[model samples]
Target chain A: MDVLVYIEHLNGKIADVSFELLGKGRELANALGGKLDAALIDANSDLATQLGSADHVVCAVDASFAQFSPMAYKNALAAMVKERAPRVVLIGNTSMGMDLAAGVSAATGIPLIAYANHIAVRDGAVVATAMVYGGKLFAEAEPEGEQVIISALAGSFSADAGKGEGAPIVEIFAAPTGGAGTQFKQLIQPEAADVDITKQDILVSVGRGIQNADNLEVVQELADALGGALSASRPVVDNGWLPKARQVGKSGVSVKPKLYFAVGISGAPEHIEGMKDAATIIAINSDPNAPIFEVADYGIAADLFDIVPALTERIKSG
Target chain B: MNVVVCMRQVPDLVEELEINDAGNDLNREYLKYVVNEFDEWALEQALLLKEAHGGTVTAIGLDLPEMDNALFTALAKGADAAKKIEGDFANGVSSHTAAKLFAGALQAMPYDLILTGVQSAEDLDGQVGVLLATYLGLPHVTVVTGVEVSGIQATVRKEYAGGMMSEFTVSLPAVLGIQAAKQAPRYAPVSKVRAMMKEKKIEGLSSSDGAASSGIKVRRMFKPEGGQRAEMIEGDADAIAERVVSILKERGLVK
Candidate 1:
């Protein structure tokens, strides 16, 4: 009943998603009456104290780890798993996590179930719940073998910083001594948008339903009337109707605006992953059953063609 | 350069889906299948690479009733050759099983690189490409947006979280999970697809080799609990606008 959680860090601080995994990992370990251990590729002092919930913190310090190299991370994690043979391993469902998990699972032949929302020990086996059919359905899965790895979907669990007063035992591990075929070059940050929608409290975000490029003017007019910034879904950015900077989705800027207006946006789970934290979300779509309505505060099931002009006029008159 | 892309036919999710009586899988009664979007990206990337660098692009998929459309579409979209493996994966096979089948069939062919979608919406598992790479003992990367191939080496742009990207140089005989193809998958007119169906032959491979157990099983599937339900505001266009304006005013989002 040993559990291991992989800790991800950026600029020496642990990513929030890693803390969420730690919280869930601690719960799973306690349920199975097992010890929880945290595995980190980089050595960061500030991160080690926050992992007090874990009985041991295994750190593999290497200069290569300053930037994420999937091969390097996979080599280190696979070695750690081989030594500890933890029953369950938890990783954050970030891009780096998915990349590393794929290689590790293949290299070790361990069972992996990604996009897990809930994990538990049932009947002496690790059971995890994951989404299928684009978040329309959920499946509960169990590993056929003794060992399993589960990637925690972001924002699924509450992150706990831990309550223990004493620092956890830290064990330093050696980096893998092999040629990493892939080299990590510089990380290219997206060019700054003329307007950083992340700083905007009110946003008028458009999606595929905007129909055509010419129709964007109406959405723009609405944004102007509402005193909000113009934003968009991935499709808009992909279609080159808007800058990539204004895109709101898993691959775009995560926004916490106060009032978010979703116009003609069908809520894909990837898009929802970014804007779900907004204070108030109002979604407008013709389809009543589009997933956007499920998370929106106000769901308007009407054509934007009919709704936009009237809404814009009202704000203008007032 | 020789490129291979693995495409999968999935239930078109735009249409309504119902739970089967077994309560563990989707009802196949009303489901219409189509090539997965991500795999379409993979196919397009392979074809684009073939166009840029002189190579033959081969597309493969498991045999299904809806598979012919996918294969012929690949041909119409400029795939040099198409293959359909004779297998009944209708009920749905694990990514591990599919990867093994692909790897087994690929062992006979000369290939410089392999590609597939990052994950399928149907299974939501992103392991097939990685498993295939592992089975073939090749270096691999996932969520690739761009790839520049040169002889035995490749430079790829891999997307990470928060819109950050990293450029990597990997040796050839590698696998990549295409997050987005360099170009949107070309739309072939149905007439072209029909013409290709009659003019070109799709090589069928029978792969009866048993795959190693996937070591994971689904216990059950159920609809997730509703997270938040929207407040329905039904009215005429003008009435709705008034309601929305008042709400916005209350929220202090308007001037």
Candidate 2:
């Protein structure tokens, strides 16, 4: 195998981003005429067995690898990379992925390209594409050396179940010790969302332009009238205006509701990827050129303040 | 305590940006520059730490024409000192090179903690702080939202996906990739910044050794591939609301 994908697991379940990378890694491996391999640290054997996309699965099931200790993962992966010498390694551009990728890249002196949206093997080297200028532009990077590791952005690629007939060859690798500088204390999950926005059929999403916490009532009224849940962009959640669970974006809930009303959301690429799968997306923003409008099914260039109340009234009366 | 904040002047993407004719980089001639957003948060964290712990916060950036204003603004916002590296960091391809530049500059300074943004808006790599930690041989954490220093070890809260948070007790002389400040970054008015510009001097450090060339190279940069155009809706408030209601009905979203 000449290409390796790190399988990320959280809360005893495989992360969706890991499967997305596997799909992408399978493509890159095919492009290079190499087998695809998956790396899992402290992952369940059953989870590794299901990664049919990979030709082989390497599991470091040490107790130390149970939780995400950057040094522990870095040391283990670095050891594997040292032994495997794969041409390219792919990781998800998530919290764990970023930490692991950076540590391994630094430890092994391998070049790393982060937030890669696309990857291709050209002339025997991985050509990774990443977004820049806050997703307004794209740049293709080619690592100057034989080895390259990239963190592919979440939602950039679709996850696919690859066709592999036989059980993948699972190699159990021993985890390395000697990480004393940092320790994993605990994982504090957000309190269960009062309303799981993912299950809602309709989502009324607000963004920074919602202005203030007091103004949320107007948007909520629309959501209430439509019999939908109220959601928000990162700013609204970060501002403590909304619970984190009601946030929609790459880092928030991925909602594919029947109708998504984006009120005042400028639609950053991160935010767009979350609800881009909505059956109907209606964006109301004051900025005519907001990127949300570009992806919206129906984009109205007006202040959401005026539109939300009017929309709420109409939904109630009509 | 001495704290260093890695600051960067990035192209203000709110303004229009054009790819240079070379096809691999931005056209610098027309783009306006401002402090990278996350780096501003990192600076605020550093300032807040200085306020609470009675330490000096020194901000450093690559020597760019527009960085003087950013450093001066930081000074007005309570940064104790500022420094700019002398080199062509614009052409640097990866965080590795930038981290090397920073490491080279910091080798002589005594510091208890170093901070930088989790990532840059332009590169979005989130690699600099980690790489800097590696080069400096220090413990490091990324995407940190909260920080508290008690003696030598600091307890920090790191944010993960799905709103998960992890608390870590990292030893001092560490690097943190600050995701956000405990509070919003303080606003420094242009007049206050101008006053600081007259009162402060950003120490210039020559990177004569030059940043080691990065292994990552840009092949090309272009706009995203085209997709279907969105349908624009035009009308007054009531008219648009009606349109939305009708569309919802058409989609069976409303009875």
Candidate 3:
């Protein structure tokens, strides 16, 4: 195998990032003139059938593999990498992927480049463009080894390209056993919905620049004036100022509102992943170089404290 | 129980970062350095564990500029001991190299749990804790939000994407990449920190020479190309607000 894409799944459903990797994996495999393989752990034939873009589907089936056991999954993936010796392994740069990528690389002694947003074959060597400094800079990097592991960031490729109908070879093998140092108890789902930000046509989103929980009223007034709900970035949610339902990001609700009025939000890629598809984005931040400006349709490089209240009053009067 | 928390300083993002002449790294001469935010949470988690389970918390960091002040601050904030791993970190070390150095320095220490930040601005790889765990032959967990210890077992709360979370019971002698603590990290008074600087000492540990390279070589570093940049609605705050209202009205977002 030339390119191996790790298929990530939850609740028996394959993750979209896995499909995105498969799309990129197919392209890289074709460039190398080799086969693209998808590695599925404890997944059913139904899931395997969905991985038609890959030339082959390698499944490691075991009872313990049903749920994500970090140690077990790490050992199994490392073993597969050793056995297959694929030139490049593509894993989604997601929460689960972050847990496994470095461990697998260390176990197999293969160099890993993470946070990759763009990858290509150059001079017969795989080079990747990785996001650094919270997406403020891009680092073009190449691994120095026969085999390399690249954890591509989510939203880097198109999921539609990886979806199609084609029969690929399927192989099943028993997973390695007996490294159970941790036990998964239960998954805590998000709190019951207070207000679904996804259903709203307009959203007033705030970030760390909101300053304090008490300061949320400034942005709340804007959202009320616009006849929309208030949402926020991860920091605001993590700070306990906003409920999880009102958060927008990869780990929060993805919102595609008609108007995304951002105040004080610096657009990290994870935060951008959720709201980038908004119809019209307007951002207000003091930092002129904030990444949020890159995605906003209109922006004001001014203090949110000064602009937000004024905007709220203007909209309210009209 | 004994705990070790690894921390590092990163270039403060508040200041604009400029690439060095090498085209592969940041220009560090005028950069302000601060403790990596997630690592502060890791230290807080360690302190919490120590306070609950009766153990000593050891704060360890690479020998970078202003690291001693961070260590003293940690000591003032409740850490029992501090150690700085001496190494050639002038240009900064990759996560791979830092993991190796940390592993080397930790080989002789007695630790029931090792904690580190899940990721940093420089190390978006999020590799150190996991790689360090691999080197130490210990089980590791990442993105952990909270940890509760009883006897030799710890029940940890790990966060997944999309507001999902899971509980895991991990055995002792494990490594955890802490995402957040139960509460915000406590602040150390400047006066107490000054007392720690005067009364306490940070032990120095030497890093092994010629630590193996991380293998991934940066060819170049550059700012991201602007993609459909937002049209600037400049001037004072009032003008900006008026323009925003007009845009919203034009788009029919508001009447």
**Best prediction by TM-score:** 3
CA deviation > 4 Å runs, candidate 3: A43-46
Residues A238-287 of candidate 2: C-alpha lDDT, one tens digit per residue:
66789888889866868899889999897777787788889889998887
Clashes of each: 0, 0, 1
Q: What CAPRI-style quality would you assign to candidate 3?
A: medium
Between candidates 2 and 3, which one is better according to lDDT? Answer: 3
Winning model by DockQ: 3
Write candidate 3's Cα lDDT for B1-255 as tens digits: 899999988888767889999998899888788988889999999998888878799999999888999999999999999999997788887888888888998988999999999888887444688888987888888988879888888888887776888788888889999888877789999999999999999999999766657888888999877669999998887787788888888988888
Cα distance off (Å), candidate 3, residue A80: 0.3
Error of 2 at A203 (Å): 1.5
TM-score (all chains, Cα) for each model? 0.93, 0.92, 0.97
Candidate of highest lDDT:
3
lDDT by residue (tens digit), candidate 3, A1-318: 389999998888899999999998988998888999999887355589899898899988876677776777888888898899999999987778987899888888889898888999998889999878777788999887667899887888999989867999998856686545877778889788788889999899999899889999999989999999999998787667888788898778788999998999988777888898999999988888888888899988888999999988898889
Give me the displacement of residue B40 in model 2, in angstroms. Answer: 1.8
Candidate 2 Cα outliers beyond 4 Å, as residue runs: A43-47, A122-125, A162-165, A286-289, A302-310, A313-317, B90-93, B124-126, B235-239
DockQ of each candidate, alpha-carbon based: 0.63, 0.60, 0.75
